[model samples]
Target chain A: MTLLAGHPTKVGRLAFVDQDYPIVLPVNFRVHRGSVVFRSDTGSKYMAAAMGQKVAFEVDDVDEAWQEGWSVLIQGMCHEITDPHQLKLIDGIGLNAWAGANMHTLEILHHRITGRRIV
Target chain B: MTLLAGHPTKVGRLAFVDQDYPIVLPVNFRVHRGSVVFRSDTGSKYMAAAMGQKVAFEVDDVDEAWQEGWSVLIQGMCHEITDPHQLKLIDGIGLNAWAGANMHTLEILHHRITGRRIV
Candidate 1:
């Protein structure tokens, strides 16, 4: 397993399974202190995490010309950010959420992070 | 829920779980006949899917300058492509693999696809 060298892009995919179906969606994100952070509406993702769901966050890149790129995967426990200090700090980061205007902050506490780069 | 207008980028993330750990990773892909396709080595993803695991594939784009983008997610059943005709057809597509040299083709039989655009 190769360790990712730098910061992950602010955009990536969040994956979780609800019932028997897998749920995967793109999320605008940030990595703060080894956790994956993003925003979600008062919908499936938020409700799942609020119920102490485990989730996966992944990001990858590819160059069609070079035919190479890398993929990173992180597994963690998800929860809503209610701590005032953390919320205030993230508020300062101002991750631009494009999908919904009233989305809430969700954080994935990292349990294992593993990645492999083809480039 | 909005329908995606065009082709998803050739790269995205694949999310699944094993032993209760959420696993998300980037994958080089192609959309053919309304399904998500990619490649993987003889690893966790492959082993898990070989056992009939359901998976999620997602892709999105973000423009930092505009602070707008779109994300798409597809839920599906994953399987190795063994049909010669299908493999030959996909061979012509030639989706590139960058991170690993000895990767094998894996395709997601999409069951549900949903997206939201922030732009």
Candidate 2:
């Protein structure tokens, strides 16, 4: 199994603006070709991708017991994978659709990633 | 210790618009009088609160072992607690400043909270 096959903290929050409302929703994601990829089923996230919106995705590992953690934030443009060749390539990336069935693949492209450690 | 004193997942992602991009940042938060409260220094979050921006906050409890979790989403207006009396009252809420010091208190007011379980 690849390290991401069953990664415990694979879930992160995807943020985007929908009609002037800033929204954040948790998503299961994986890294592919230096971008964040996830599956969504015609939801807000999917709509954001379809609209080619700029978004922020955040993932963190924290030990609340010790009050410490590090977080990585990525800002990028969302793109829905539609090309058959690319979709087939992404299918081999070992990412699962943990959210639901009938999903579409989306990736955050041109990522500007940053991380901070809270010690 | 109240349930939140050492809650393992008390940290959540606070989302709001900065410029034209939607951004989400991890925050250690607690519920105070039906509002979500956290401490932040002068940063993007602080500016959002000062502007009374409408924002969304998301917190989730996930079990990657079982691929199940529940997330609560909150939509509200961010308020910076500047009133001396209110600040003094919030000081006793027991929510630690897990990130850093010299923090200012902010709360999401008029919460419209909703939750969903993923199985």
Per-residue alpha-carbon lDDT of candidate 2 for residues B34-100, written as tens digits (9 for 90 to 100): 6788888655443544358889888887775577877777787887778888777778866666576
Residue A73 displacement in candidate 2 (angstroms): 1.2
Chain B alone vs. reference chain B, TM-score for every model: 0.82, 0.80
Local accuracy of candidate 2 as per-residue lDDT tens digits, A1-114: 133334466887888877667767888887776677888776644354435888988888776668787777778888877888977887886666655663678888855777
Query: Over the stretch A12-72, how does candidate 1's per-residue lDDT look in tens digits?
Result: 6676768776677766777656576777766644345434677777776666567666667
TM-score of chain A of 1: 0.82
Q: Which candidate should be chosen as best, given lDDT against the real structure?
A: 2
Candidates, DockQ: 0.62, 0.67
| Residue-wise C-alpha lDDT for candidate 1, range B3-82, written one tens digit per residue | 33254456666767777765776667776666776766655443454335787777777675576777677887788787
Candidate 1 Cα misplacement greater than 4 A, ranges? A1-9, A43-51, B1-8, B43-51
Give the C-alpha miss distance for residue B117 in model 1, angstroms: 2.4
Assess the local accuracy of residue A1 in candidate 2 as a C-alpha lDDT between 0 and 100. 14
Off by over 4 Å in 2: A1-7, A43-50, B1-7, B43-50
